[model samples]
Target chain A: MNQYTAQQWRRYTIRVGIYVALLLMTAIFLIPVYVVIVTAFKNPAEINLASTWQLPTELYWQSFSEVMAEFGPRFGNSVQLVIGATILSSIMGSMNGYVLSKWEIPGHKFLFPLMLFGMFIPYQAILIPLFEFMRDIDLYGGIPGLILIHVVYGLPITTLIFRNFYVDIPDEMLEAAAIDGAGFWKLYTDIVFPLSIPGFVVVIIWQFTQIWNEFLFAVTMTSNDAQPITVGLAQLAGGEAVKWNLPMAGAIVAALPPLIVYIVLGRYFIRGLLAGSIKG
Target chain B: MKNNRDRSIAFLMLLPSLILLGIFVYFFIGRAIQSSMTDWGENPAQPPLSETVEISYVGLDNYVRLMTSFTESSFRVSLVNTFFFTIFFVAGCIMVGLFLAILLDQRVAGEGIFRTIFLFPMALSFVVTGTIWRWMLQPRGGVNILPTLIGLDPIDFAWVNSQETWFQFLWQDVPRILTFVGIGILLIMAVRYALNQRWRSMGFVAAAAIVGLLVFMAGAWDYIWPALDVPAAEPTIAPKGFNVALLGVIIAAVWQMSGYTMAMFIAGIRGVAEELREAARVDGASELGVYRYIILPQLNPIILSAMIILGHISLKIFDLVFAMAGPDNAKTIVPGILVYTKGFRANAFASASAVAVIMLFFVAIIIIPYLWTQLRSDDD
Candidate 1:
């Protein structure tokens, strides 16, 4: 009885220790973020000499206005790009998934595998060729090009998701809808899309984050005219007179939009992550 | 009829994406391969403005150059670093992620806060995140501050790029007693596996223990010794040895990736059927046995799929390394970053494109089997 009691206490202590250690690591993860937040509010003079780990003598907001005047619309462009791509790609992906699940389309078996190969090629491989394609068509410098590449870039995962989820749904329900002679528009807008909102939300948030945070394609495809906030802000900081305060301010501004969207639609991000992770 | 319409609708919907796949994924991959063969690199300038720029069809010239060229120090390190970098990345992300996943999975207090905190790294762009992390990891920066406060000797980042790590990689690592013991166990287990026969349950357990030991040793040995010899440090910005900065850089990668891992695992856990738990209880199985047998079986598909995807993700990982090591030394990879440096920055766009093509091919060799299995398994 005494030995049993001892074992119980030991187990309790170990569990507590593990939890504390985890809490500590989690704190470590947040330190850099904390630094960004504190530094964003500090002055140029303050940030230059002040320890990144230390708080400034006073809360400074001078850089915020400077950042806003410089890159505010670019931030909006980024948002528009993310929302547009997420909606377009998820719509396309879900629709494809629904069709493949519901009907026996000719050549989908081959076409789908061919498309699956897209996920295999790294972003670097197609940079030049894609540039040539975009440049040839004159879509290389605008939001239209960014949207095209992003939608294309993200389609495989989104299609894979909608397909997997559609497979799990009963085919008889779709057949019943079809027996009523429902056309594609009615079926998609009413039946298929409504049923797939949870999945759609997940894909939307995930895609939004990707397009928002994307740097390379934004850097490559579009030069200055429609360069997403990622490339714009990064280049802004690349100047010789680059101050830590200004970039930290830009970074904080850049992070806030997605971070807000993330928090608002936060629940779906987890769901999307799981669905996206549909392996093992 | 509904199925017919749905099928057509699906076909139309999938069309744009199919075109994307054709142009971006499939066609680009083809171009990458073709570009590797063509003499795209700087050619001797000729009179009369040659229209073709002398696209010589040199089969395997790019590969040979990649293999034989010892001219660029960082280029060589990046190529060799590819496999080891991938191993460290996969190992780190999974280990750190699994630890957090388990921690967050517990019925502990403030779990949501912890989860959110851990996940915040995913929010920042690699450019900003990379630059910031670079500063933080600077041996002179205060990234080591928190550690210093704890009184457990803070790390000096200077030695991270120092020469001590370089010279050790080309030689065999000295074996310690623990490693020798591990070797003996492996020898015994290899003999056991070769002579597969009906053995006592204890023998099965013993063999399992040896296999586990081998895996553990694989990780330990990789960490304990440098993969390359550390040459003495030079005054220039050149990389010396398997720079210690690589490890610090990957630690940053781990921080960024672990949140996704945790989020994915949580989803997988949630998807596990509750009925299985009741069934296990009815079968009089212990809770541990229920988790081991039932929960794990269901998790197998999700885990395997995650591994394949994450494995490939780590293989192509560029942002984190770029963020941690800067573009020059710390994050060089064989295919991706090497191409970037050579092609665009170095003005040898031809060689860079060639490098890009080679990377695509290497990625294919890894991805083909994964695609085959996923499609086949789905078909089954």
Candidate 2:
């Protein structure tokens, strides 16, 4: 009885230790979020070095109003860009994945790896040529062009995630549809497409977050009129005589859409994240 | 007849993507390679953006200059900075991730909440992360002032603007250092192969190691790649090393990405069969021993995958550094920023493409092997 009590006590101590460690880590991870929130809420007059960590005296609505005014157009641009790009890329990825995984496409063994390689190359390697090509085609500076860039570049990973997702779907299901005189299009629509809602969710979340948060293409591919929220936030934070509150507000505003998606559908988000890297 | 038609339909469906990817990924890469070997922006006669400009082929002149030119010290520094950043960022993510995974694996309360807090940052843009961290790491405010709340002097460390460097090395010695590092890796590989009793592979690795050692001893690096030699006029010995300013950027990067690794590890830890762990515990293993001996070994592949993913991300890191330390801050410059500033700002297209090509080479070095192994495993 004494030995058992000692073991229980030790286990209790270990559990307590784990919680403490976890809480400490949690605090560290959330520090920036805390700072960003507090800074965003603090009035410009109250924002300074000495009172950095202090809670705001009162809620300040001015920063958000000002940031919204400045970033309103860019925010719309990001939405349009993300939505257009996400839908196009996800549809294409699903079809490609369906064909590659379910159909008997020749050279798929070689093609899959070739496509996978595209996602990993530093986009910098192709940036110059892409810039020139965009210019030559008169698609250099608009939301549509940016959408195209995102969709094309996004194909590899979206296709990858969907392919991995589709491989799990039994081939017998497809064979049955084929035997029912369902041609390729009918089979996909009847059997595969309906079953891919979960895959679509994963791909959509991944692409939305990626295209929304993307800075390089947004900054480079778009002109001033088509700049995304990322560019606006960058300029807001990057100015010489910036009020911290405004940029902090901008950061929060820019981060919210994806944050909401992540918080709500986090399981699918993680599935997308893991699928992009780890093989199924 | 139906199968042939179906195959044709499949081919037709794949055609557009194949064409797009071919142009955007492969064909454009070829174009960038060609652009990098030109004098488009270097020569006075060929303005980079001119409608009717001449672009003469320079045959690796841009690469040679980037590697050795006195004016291009920034490129070399950026290269070294990326190397250090990748090492620390990858290692930090794995350690933090593994720890968090272990802690959460203990059936902790509110695991979902803790996980959400940890991972929410991953959803934010690097630009957002950079902006927030830039504020938090302000020299006079933010994190620096946190100590004051606890009754200490406000810490005054310059997070993003520090000019201090660590582990300094002369530019002239880079070749020797690379050679030595290569030899070290080969030696390690040889040992691992020996342990596995793979004599033929071990013999090949040993041969490579011996050749690397001979090259190092003979000091043939400069003679073989003469561009690495410092130019005579700038003989003051350009020094390159890890800049302290990048510490803040690396910290922010790790903060954002460690969650990803944690997720990977948690999945890996959960995948470990309960029976294996129970058996280990029954054999008198401590909880720590079960993790250190059993769980961690099974997580090796997750760790490798995480490392490769994070490594490539770090290698091409641009936006975070750009947002935290603006494009012109030489102290925190990276190749991605250099490409941006050079091509976009300075119109130095040739040099920009050269830097970009170098970045691609480094990424390819890490990614190709990973993809090969990963895809091959899928085939099996």
Off by over 4 Å in 2: B184-207, B227-238
Q: Could you give the interface RMSD of candidate 2 in angstroms?
A: 1.4
Give a tens-digit lDDT track for model 1, residues A1-280.
9999998998898788878888689777977777777777887777652266778789898888988888877887897788788889988888778777666778767666666667556788887677667877888778988998899988887887788777877777766876787777776676777888777877788888878988768866776767788776666665445577777788788878778876777777666665544342
- Candidate 2 local distance difference test against the native: 0.90
Q: Could you tell me which residue pairs clash in candidate 2?
A: none
Docking class of 1: medium
Q: Which ten residues in a row have the lowest lDDT in candidate 1 chain A?
A: A271-280
User: Tens-digit lDDT track for model 2 on B1-380?
Assistant: 14778878988998899999999999999999999999988888767798998989999889888877778978888988898999999999999998888888988889999999888889999999999999888899888888788889988789889978889877676788788889899899999999999999999999998987887788787665556545553334335788899999999999999999999999999999999999999999998999999999999998889989999999999999989999988888899999999998899999999999999999999899999899999976
Global lDDT of model 1: 0.68
lDDT of 1 by residue, B1-380 (tens): 53555556657776766777787877876776776676665555521124456666778665555533444445555655665666777777766765677666657788877877777677666766765665565564557554665666666555224343443342222334445666677567656765776356446657766666766667766654333333332213344245554666666777777787767666666677778778888999965577678766776665565566666776566655554454555434445666666665654555666777756667777677777776767776
